[model samples]
Target chain A: MSNATQPTAKPDERVKEISAFRNALIRPELGGIVGTVAVFTFFLLFAFDSGMFNSQGIMNWSVVSAQFMIIAVGACLLMIAGEFDLSVGSMIGFAGMMIAIFSVTYGWPVWAAIIVTFVLCTAIGALNGWIVIRTGLPSFIVTLAFLFILRGFTIFLPQVIERKTIIGGILDVAEGDWLAPVFGGTIFKGLFVWLGEAGLIATFERGTKQGQPVVDGIPMLIIWAIALIIFGHVLLTKTKFGNWIFAAGGDAEAARNSGVPVNRVKILMFMFTAFCATVFAVCQVMEFGSAGADRGLLKEFEAIIAVVIGGALLTGGYGSVLGAALGALIFGVVQQGLFFAGVESSLFRVFLGVILLGAVILNTYIRRIITGER
Target chain B: MTGNSKFHHGDPKGAVQPIIEMKNIEKHFGRVIALAGVSFDVKPGECHCLLGDNGAGKSTFIKTMSGVHQPTAGEIFFEGKPMHFDDPRDAISAGIATVHQHLAMIPLMSVSRNFFMGNEPTRKVAGISFFDKKRADEVTMEEMRKMGINLRGPDQAVGTLSGGERQTVAIARAVHFGAKILILDEPTSALGVRQTSNVLATIDRVRKQGIGVVFISHNVRHALAVGDRFTVLNRGQTLGTAARGEISPEELQDLMAGGQELAQLEGSLGGTV
Candidate 1:
């Protein structure tokens, strides 16, 4: 692939250059791209007339995918730094519950509740990294322990403070809160209204909301996802710190010898993962106007699955944030496409399993080609 | 050995003050005396080979010199100034670079990435620092070319390169980063004959560039091939230091094998037990 661009008349005879086609096949994003195109094609073929591609339907799946993309970005970075945070789901549930308990039960301002929850969750994330680094334990076991601990606190706290495992009326307290809009609010409302007036999209026909676009505007969740994806991609590919992340994950000892601060990198990645989870939690809380103990269930695994499907090696060091985002997009499309196509929704799990396996196989083959290993 | 005629003992270039000098260096790990009063020095443009049999304190001595281990007692002078290195990074900043047998490089990363791993060149765009990948790639190719390794591309992974090329990458990196004294530990131990020759030639090039080299190996032939001066370590102490032509390969091997110990063992076991 790199040979074609070289203007040098004589190529280095020593380098047994693989063909450009095979070189293209070795990109980490190939699996994710293929999977994404295939999923979109499948949905477009079977669910086309079912309104899956309509404005509202597109918004629905895009929101769902943006959620996965947010967390997958964090998980992908952490994994590439050679760590895992099984507590991501629990962190979400805990963060949401904390916001509800502070704002609703304790009568705190919604903004304060959200900010405090972010700080607290980020601290917990740091603690996770600290323990992993100081004890030399596998991050898998350390984070798995926090998963149950945080989940237990999530359920126990709301019940103790409000006499219920669920908290509601966050929307009422957050009605005029300045910060609430950033997480729960939409953008381009005027544009959507224009879109409706221009007959570019469908509008409500018979309610008090008549003449309004069915999709009010783009959600903040999607905005956050795209921003994070861009941020992560640039950080990984264009910065020296990004190079350090790869080196740290690829070989910690070697990276250390080369003067890369491997420990600090891993710890920051864990904190970033927690920050992402908190972002998801806050968005979900604001959108639903409530918090539940069962919120974000199995989300950690889903995020990992998305990252893996996007072509990240489970062993760490080799991955792409864009690939993970595409994986998240695939997840969202397939999950909703099943509903749109009128298939059994439960089959989504089976599809995830199959796609995950196929991606791993493809990624393994690419790894072998890059490493020249059989 | 073919280049032996090109160097002479006490050559004018070797008469300069040593770039790095260790005096009465000692290291202890609990009760084990890893190094005992070993004095060595390398002048600019000189390849000083440290040869020893296995477990002869060569590894510990080099580790101490490279700042991986602090000497228990010693005086280290760089450019005639006493120095203390808290860690490897400190030594690196002082222009002492060590390329261990296991090169400190990520195998899966591209050549340019691995070449500029820690000390990455960055260009500021709109007040945001981004890796200067064009410069890094160009410099990596140029450096590798200087070492006579024609890379396919800078994007090629380090793992795909032969052992000899990898060594050249490391040496070129150290030299590029302004390493005044280069310490190589067992660079040729695991390489084939052709690869070993390539690395030795690279060492010769680095030496000619006025960088002091401490080449560590037990392979007598390898040391003799590139060494300007030879120091033999035996049982945690230096037997002696000899200029290139002052010592023959057989004599260097005998010293590294611990001549006194070999004779004692021969007396006890009839020489071939």
Candidate 2:
């Protein structure tokens, strides 16, 4: 219509060019980016003198952040596909427990145990998605049901077979195990050793391992977090399947009408979420050399909160994996930053609730902007 | 209207074979019959309007034609060949694309993304095939432009467009994807006067490209504006089909409102008056 009045071709005037500020506000990652900056600024101002920025302190929070990052990446994608997996925490505990049972109680090789655990966990994830699709029930309710079921088994099976809810000795069995190192081992050991030798890093002064860097190497957990984030980000933004994910979450009927395989996208997202949780679990059990029934307690909600904070809509169909990763980073920093700043550790939960509410409000506002609705 | 007039009044109906022909189609849902014995045909470069009121089997007839529902009994000939469509996808592959009232678009998605929702353009680098965003964006803008719509940008959200513009996008998408027969289900039912005009103009542009159009609507004036022939349906039955010059708007409206039933009511009330 705008083309009619002007003899010379001009840009369509109907769509008034939005201000740069407003355009930036429309991005799904805005809230996550802002929150990350604010949280980091606050912690840096308050905890800079407390060794929080030191190599050891950085590693401490990075490890914590990586834990959240792993599961948050999964939750972010699944949420974008318009579903939830409330069973992630339970999945972690259950997967770890299964690995322990398979390796320790059954005396299976550690590699076989880890592989079976991954397969079994992914299968259960697929089952979660299948049940949701077949029954037409809300994914929240379905995954909630699994939360209890998996956690119940996590506690029950160990007690029945080993007479305890906690299993240990995995570190010994995992020694020299091929697959275990992928989840449990560290990388860049030579670099850290070089840094320690060159006096660029803090070295243990008086221990049996004198001159070893306090920050030894980058752990596999952090590596997994980075790898998964990159994978999820690429999968969500750069592929045809990524577009289908957005369409499926935005409107399933519309997507289906357009010939998109909505159900398959949703199911794959669910399985990916479960896979992320298993990675977190395996890394945890390897690092700690034990699996407790409560190993991953409340981790699902934590992952969901991280996703929401990263600016993913709880209602689904709009989000960023990068945003979710940053949200996880915020969680890691603040949780450890509290200790460095001498704040109570329990304040982290309170912070989570507050940040989650703020992020949701921001997301709702962004959604309104995108949809041009109230 | 004047620019598009030459093609609008071309009248290529008789010499051309119908792109789609439905003969004696019947659709029954359990005990109720949604459509019965409805015969219709659309020649290339023709807009055959199916006029009906609510519950006049307009929806049922279109659904049956679009492969949403298998007809209880009927023969559908596409391109002079008898065929059965198992689903909407089958119909789509057969070059019959249906643009439903809601348009089946994600509002928050960019126009380019929505245009290529299911059928995305892609390029491969190092064995990794990714969506070719630049190509998609350019094609979307170019297509919209050809349909007389000047989109702000390819990245502009579909929700930001006017209702008529969205309809144009849907129509353009269907046409771009090799749709030989475009079935528009009430494409302008919820638009303002100007928006409706724009959509009608879009329909005219599409028909001139030699695509058989099945324009389903209850609006008599809309049907009369662009349709080469008008077919009226009532109570799951075809009242009749009339070419453009043979049927007046008043007669078309009366037929759509069930002319015999209206005449019977008038006669019954005459004695009392």
Candidate 3:
């Protein structure tokens, strides 16, 4: 083996470069990147005439990916910190209901309702963290319990207080409010409209307006998702706290011995997950102009799958926010792509399962190489 | 190995006070007694071996000293000043660092990241302050080199390192953080002969830096090789503390019950081999 690769007789005196470029190419996110390309191409070939490649179609999937990523970013960070928050999906439903009932039924301003919802969600997240830490229970079980508790409350509260399963009037309550634009609705809507009007984008051949295209303004969810991903990426990779999160997840005892406040880091991670869920709830309420008790169902699973596909270990401590973002994108494209191709929507779960299995296996193989594990 | 002469290079000679002095320390784990009234002291710039067999309270004593558990009753003095540590961080802040057998370095993290860990360096990039990767890499390499560990890449994950190298990283990290007293828990138990020598050499280098070293081990030969002084423990009590030359390796083993156990095993075998 030693004789196979011979070195020069004399070492180079000047600075010599190693194959650093190759090393950079095989980063942990490479699996996600490769998987995304393969999936995108496969769909592109079969679904070409289905408008899946069109700008509107792309935007539709991107919006879906954004919604998934907002929570996935949080879930990814929490996973890196060695925990899970299954209640995030339930928190979404609960937060939406809180915002709706407070504003529409109690006559509270939309802004006040949003603030209260966030505070309540934050508290619920802390309780999840606290119970897990204090009682020394598995976060999976604790958050699973929280999942049911919050979901039950979301459904039960509307029946008891609002006397309704679904509450409307979210946009009506948000109307004429200063804070509405911040938490709800679109941005640069007029700009996109202007672009469409200027023939920069495809316009309708025949419609009520004659020229306006079906593609509307950029969704606020997409903007918030990108911003949150940046924040999560920095917080996971740039800060001292980020280092602590990795250490804590990799080995909690080792991290504690190293003087990392693991409990605090995990608790803060749980809070972030809840906060992301709340953001999703706000956007959904704004987008639909209505709130339902069953909103955000199975979102936690989507976020976890995205995080896992992004190359995070289900056991924790190894992942990237960018990878999770890519994972979300993959899920969104496949889910929407199949629909555009006229495939049955129920097959989406099967597709999700197959993709999750393949991504995880690929991720595991990549991780073995990165960790140099035999 | 037997005299003050072994400590010629920067070793605290003749008149230095003990870095840490534990007096009549006692610890209990609920219904079980892990350690019973034991006294230990480590002076600056010398390897003090804590010799014991399994369940001999060596681990418990180290934990108590390192602040993993509060002593049920005892007093600990740091540099002759009585101190109390509620957590490991307190002890660490007081310049005492413990390298447990399963060293504190996270295997998945890079050498530099593991080295900095909770005490990372930070700098601003595009007006956003973050952990300073450049500084961490530089210092980790420098400290490791000082310990005779020349790592080719600071970003290499620590899990890829051998046991002895991981121990070296832990020691280097402790030294980097300005630890005055180093507590190594069975540092060489799982290492091969070559790796054990590497660890011993690191201990020697650390001692030359004028830091107190507590070397916990069951191997008498290994301890006798570098230890300036040795303290023997048996069943949670101090058998005796001996300075180098005060006792031989064979004698230390006897005190740790190694001789008796060997004799019992020989009797059990009844001269079959």
Candidate 2 lDDT over B1-273, as tens digits, reads 113122223234557888888899999999998888888988988899988999999998888888899999989998899989998889999999999887889887899999999999989989999999999999998998888777767988887887988898999999999999999999989999878887888888888899989999999888888888888888898877777787677566667766667566657877231
All candidates' chain B TM-scores are 0.90, 0.91, 0.89
The lDDT per prediction is: 0.90, 0.89, 0.84
**Model 1 over residues A141-257: C-alpha lDDT tens digits?**
999999999999999998888899999999999989999999999999999999999999999997999999999999999999999999999999999999999998999988988
Question: Docking quality tier of candidate 3?
Answer: acceptable
Best by lDDT: 1
Model 3: residues with Cα > 4 Å off, grouped in runs: A1-26, A204-213, B1-14, B28-36, B72-74, B125-128, B258-273
Q: What share of the true interface contacts does each candidate keep?
A: 0.51, 0.45, 0.47
> Against the true two-chain complex, what DockQ does each candidate achieve?
0.42, 0.40, 0.37
Alpha-carbon DockQ of candidate 2: 0.40
Residues B106-160 of candidate 3: C-alpha lDDT, one tens digit per residue: 8778899999998999998788779988889999887877766656589777876
Model 1 Cα RMSD, Å?
4.6
Which structure is stronger by TM-score: 1 or 3?
1
Global Cα RMSD, each model: 4.6, 4.6, 5.1
Given candidate 2, what's the lDDT at residue A33?
93
| Candidate 2 Cα RMSD (Å) | 4.6
